[model samples]
Target: MTAHFVDLLDDLRRRSLRMAQLVEEVVREACEAVFQADVEKAKRVVQRDNDVDAEEVEVESEVIRLLALYQPVGSDLRLLCTVLKVNNDLERIADCAVNVAERARHVDARTLAGPYEDLRQMGPIVVHMLHNAVKAYGSQVVDDAQRVLLEEDAVDALYGQIIRRLVAEASASPAKIAAFLDVLSVAKNLERIADHATNIAEDVVFVCTGEIVRHRMH
Candidate 1:
């Protein structure tokens, strides 16, 4: 690759990382909105989704442009591919945050105390997962990515617990089904965010080790 191309690639990677940081903040705000019942925080998260969406497109375009113009091979190609995949995942993560914030706008956090507590626990785990995933991406470290993978099962388990509790609670209090569904929505989005974080980690592993570990059990 030419020096100019390499410089462009580095710039694109840095841009993607900035986007990742922005998405992380959005997730944190969304979590605060839901757990603390902060409507203004939720609104901020929603507004920031627009920026994430636009950056996703720009990153994707630059990735494609580099591939077409430079025809990068080996690690360069892998890095480009990983950037594209991570870009998509980051955008989806922002969308998931928006979903959580939207649910927060309706539900009363105090009323969701018992059953929704699992979601509270799940939020930090998901955020930590994404943080590790983004760190792995930036550092291109297999170990950091592996750590993110390890956290996925915990998030999944908590999500399942929340689902079961919501089901039981809904059956007992049918009139409060709307609130239960709101909690379910938040849980589902958080679970999806965890899944995206896992995808990012898998991409990091692939980029570093050239291992296709996607479908294989870690």
Candidate 2:
């Protein structure tokens, strides 16, 4: 690779990493705001989503520029493509965080039955997947990408349990029905964030191995 090509690739890598960091922060903060019932923090998460969207646009533009300018082939080409896909995924994850924060902001006075332990559990799992998927992309680690994929089932299982418990609780409590439903919606958003993270991990795998394993693996 020419010096110019290497420099361009490095720029793409750095920008993608920055975007990942911002998205992960938004997700974490949104979860915390929900748990703490901090309306101000939730508002911040909502407001910061625009910045994540802007970052996605910037990453997409950079990827296209690299494609046009350097015409990267093989691994370089795959990395650029994965960056484009993963950029979209990260932006969508941020949008999910915003949705969760929005739900938190309008919560009624009635207390949510018990703590949101399951939602809390899902948060770190998704965050770790986001971190590992991005790290794998940065280092071109195909195995790490696959590991992220394997972790998605756990998120899905947790989501299922959350749904069942919330349904039962909401059905039992007529008074706190609305609050329970809001909590359920928030959990759904968190689950979707994990789904988006998994999508990015799959893109990373393709970027590294040239294999689209989306449908092949359950």
Candidate 3:
């Protein structure tokens, strides 16, 4: 029974790592599509969302099977629960990537007068956060998880800068309104992706320390 349970836990961890890698690819390609103005990459991101959805369903099914078969208690139960929460976070991150890709497809590259820089800055931060959050989950390291949480502020600040730039551009050229708005939407999606990464970090903390840090549980 002990060996079987350990094997199940390992399988869950492996599945989570795979999910994390897929999400990272999604975010990376989405940003590449936007910044490079690569329509094909953007379309690929949109097309691949279904694959992430299917992976989510598969992971959930595996978790459910493990729960019913082992009826995990204590730490085992916590691990299973954390996997479910993180699974949701990863899926949502993929959705956000698709949103960014769609926005990229709408953006008129000719009208975009070099103001997509903020989105470029926002991309790496969120990507790093997602990568580190997954590392925290895989290694069960609280510090890595905490780092992901703390980096949220950086992304928020970048978003503010992006907003200020967009407002200035909108005032300067009303004709560019549609293009600027698309850029803004892309930045917003990246910010929300960072938020989901933070949620994953919080889940990692709970899985490790057995403390729910999501909200004030009073």
Candidate 4:
């Protein structure tokens, strides 16, 4: 790759990192909206989804353009590919935040105090996972990416616990089924966010080591 192409690639990587930061904020706001019952914060999260969607398209376009024009190989090609994949994952994470925010609009925090405590714990863990994933992507460090992978299991376990608790609670109080479903929606979205974060981390590992560590256990 030429010097000019290398500079452009660096710019694209920085742009993608900025988008990651924005998505992280959206997730944090969505969590606060739900846990604190802040309707305005939920609305802000929903509104920011539009911005994330537009940025996703722009980032993908730039990646394709770079590939066609520069025909980058080796690490340059891997970096472009990683940026494209991470861009898509970040957009999806934003959408998951919107889903959580939408559920926050209806879910009662008071009602979530008992059986939904697991979800409350899951939110911060998911956010932390995403933060580490973005950091790994920025630094292109295998260790940071591996750390994000380690946290995914904890989020999954908490999600499973929430599901079991909701099932039992719903069985006992059929009338509160709607609230239970709302709580479940939030948990599901949080779990999906964690999955997307893991995907980003996996891409980072691939970029750093040229090794595909996606589908194997751990």
Candidate 5:
């Protein structure tokens, strides 16, 4: 490939990274809206999801253009594919963050703060998982990506604990059923975000090692 292609690839990679930064900020604000009961933040998150969706289309268009025009081989090809997959996962994660934000508008984290400690804890852990996954995508480091794989277990465990507690306690405080379901929705979306982050991490490993580790024993 020519130096021109290299320059194009670099620019596309940077564009994707900027999109990642935007998605990360949206997720963080969604979590903040949940804990802080800030309806304004929740609204901002929804607005940014549109931005993410548009960026997703643009990034994908650029990838297709590069593949068609340059037909890169070897590492360049892998990196482009990784950027495309990561872009998709980032978009989905942004959608999940929007889901959480919508829930935040209705149910403040404080309402369920006492009994559902695990629900609150899941937010930051999921965010950290996403942060690390995005870091791995940017760094293309297997070690960083592997660290994200390790985190899924904690998130799954916390999700299970939250569900169990919600079930056990909902009947006791019948009046708070609405709050319980809100907590459930938040936890469910957080778990989904973790899953998406893990997917991004796996793609990063694929980029670095060229090994498809999707269903492998992590």
Candidate 6:
């Protein structure tokens, strides 16, 4: 690749990382919005979704332009592909964050503290997992990516526990059904965010090693 092309690729990667950071903040805000039942914070998250969407489109366009104009080979090409894939995942995570934030108005975290424990634990793990994935992508280090992958199982396990607890506990607490659904929705979105974070980590591994690690053992 030409020096100019390399410069452009580096710029694009940085742009993608900035987007990831924005998405990560949004996820944190979403968690706070719902857990604290702060309607205003949730609204801010919804507004920021527009910015994330616009950035995602811009990054994707740059990827396509580079692919057609420069036709990078080997690792350069792998990097372009990783940026594109990571961009998509980041956008999806933003959408999930929005979903979680929207559920804030219905949640009463204090009242639902019994069921909210696992979900509360789940949120920060997913956020840290996302942070690790973004850091790995920026550093292009397989070890950093593996850190993200390692946390996915913990998030998944917590999600499962939430589902089971909600199912078993909801029947007895019929009056709080609305709040229960809101809690479930938040848990589902958090689980999805973890999944997307894992996808980014898997892409990072692929970029660094030229090996696909999606469906197989880690």
C-alpha TM-scores of all predictions? 0.98, 0.90, 0.91, 0.98, 0.96, 0.96
**Candidates 1 and 2, the one with greater TM-score:** 1
Worst 10 residues of 2 by lDDT: 107-116
lDDT of 1 by residue, 1-218 (tens): 48998899899999999999999999989998988899998999999999999999999999999999999999899999999999999999999999999887798988667647778899999998999988988899999999999999999899989989888988999999898889889999999999999999999999998898998787
lDDT of 4 at 47: 92
State the local distance difference test value for candidate 4: 0.92
- Candidate 1, residue 26: CA error in Å? 0.4
> What C-alpha lDDT do the candidate models reach, one value each?
0.92, 0.82, 0.86, 0.92, 0.91, 0.91
Q: Which of candidates 1 and 3 is the stronger one according to TM-score?
A: 1
What is the Å distance of residue 194 in model 1 from its true position? 0.2
Q: Model 2 — TM-score against the truth?
A: 0.90
List the candidate 1 regions with Cα displacement exceeding 4 Å. Answer: none
Q: How close is candidate 6 to the true structure, as a TM-score?
A: 0.96
Candidate 2, clashing residue pairs? none
**lDDT by residue (tens digit), candidate 2, 5-68:** 8888888889888888888889888877876778899999988899998888888888988898
lDDT of 3 by residue, 50-99 (tens): 89899999999999999898889998899999898889888999999998
Clashing residue pairs in candidate 5, if any? none
How would you encode candidate 6's per-residue C-alpha lDDT over 17-73 as one tens digit per residue? 999999999999998898788999999999999999999999999999999999899
Error of 2 at 10 (Å): 1.2
* Per-residue C-alpha lDDT of model 5 across residues 60-155, encoded as one tens digit per residue: 999999999999999999999999998988999999999999987789657758777778889899989989988888888899999999999999
Instruction: Show how many residue pairs clash in every candidate, following the order shown.
Output: 0, 0, 0, 0, 0, 0
Off by over 4 Å in 5: none
Q: 1 or 2: which has the higher lDDT?
A: 1
lDDT of prediction 2: 0.82
